[model samples]
Target: MKTLLEAHNLSKLYGNGRSQVVALKDVSISLFPGECLALMGPSGSGKSTLLSILGLIIRPTSGCVLVQGKPVEEDERSRARLRNEFFGYIHQEFAVIENETVEKNVMIPLQYARIKPSRQERQSRILQLLKQLNLDWAVHKNVSFLSGGERQRVAIARAIINHPSVILADEPTAALDRKSAEEIMGFVLSMRDQGCSVLIATHDERIAKTCDRVLHLVDGRLL
Candidate 1:
């Protein structure tokens, strides 16, 4: 199978000279279609940095990211396009708008879609996904009123609403209880089973065990 995403000799540096910190060092990784890969490491071990680069959320100080075997240009427009069209990102912090309704937050992605959906179609799709994630009841509730698990569910619904080719999750289960974590993983893995490549940065052994492959990182380098 063709690789869905590839990172070659990637490195990210912050600051300069004596004040500089190395976030990622010469790390290379790949995600293939229909596969689930786990990135396990301690905090500040570069898992988030790698995910950011792969998802085009940030540019690598060095090296390149390829999609379907072609190197992506480092232009803002191109990056934004790829991020919206090809990548689904589930952030550890639950990157949802606290003031917005659950339905509105999930519909944000659809607005930027390459071929924008009709207002009616967008509503139907959001409703269907929220129902699947068991969040239909909170469709009109403000995000700030929801609990951590509910917020995470809203994040998941937003991430996959665009039907991205790759899902990049950074410690998605970190803030959830065991039951909620399992539910979250189930939703993510279901996407993988349906042919979306998945890369999750996690500290949970149980979560790592469920992936098709696992990679370890320490001090910015892959082990």
Candidate 2:
């Protein structure tokens, strides 16, 4: 399989000297197209920090990330472009703009990716994505009016709008009921089956078991 994302001997440090916190120490991971990988650990085990680095949102203090064998430098402009083009993130909080309409939120990625779509084209695709998640009815509503499940669906649609090669989800199902969690996982698994590499940072064993592989994060090292 082709590697979609790779972290080479990565480590992240915060602060300086004696007060510095080592978030990730010599951690390396890779995600390939069409596979799902899960990272399981308790709080502060460096799962989210690792995902941030792989997504190119946060730079690693040491080591490098490569996309298709090219090293990702600490170029803000370039990294932002790579993030829009290559990775999709689903935060634990489902970070949607509360004041924005669902459709507007979904279109954010298209803008970031510099994809110029005709108004109709953009509307059509966003509607289609919302419809897929049974969210078409909520398309015009502000995200603040939606329930937890609805918000997550909107987040999912937006994350996938660019058809990203890799997706990093942090505790994707932690806030949902079992059925809702399963429903969300169903969509994520479908994405994997359709060739999107997925990396999930979660503490739920049941969720981890659904993936192609599950690795534990203990003291910043994969177990």
- The TM-score leader among the candidates is 1
Residue 163 alpha-carbon offset, candidate 1, angstroms: 0.2
lDDT of 2 by residue, 19-122 (tens): 99999999888887788999999999999999999988888888999997788867698899888878889987899999999999999988766767887888
Q: What is the lDDT of candidate 2?
A: 0.89
Q: Per model, how many backbone clashes are there?
A: 0, 0
> What is the overall TM-score of model 2 with all chains considered together?
0.97
The 10 consecutive residues of candidate 1 with the worst lDDT sum are 186-195
Q: Can you list the residue pairs that collide in candidate 1? A: none
lDDT of 1 by residue, 1-223 (tens): 7898999999999999999999999999999999999999999999999999999998889999999999998679888989998999999989999999999999999999889999999999999999999999999999999999899999999999999999999999998889888999998999976779999999899999999999999999999
lDDT of 1: 0.94
lDDT score at residue 79, model 2, on the 0-100 scale = 91
Q: Against the correct fold, how does model 1 do in TM-score?
A: 0.98
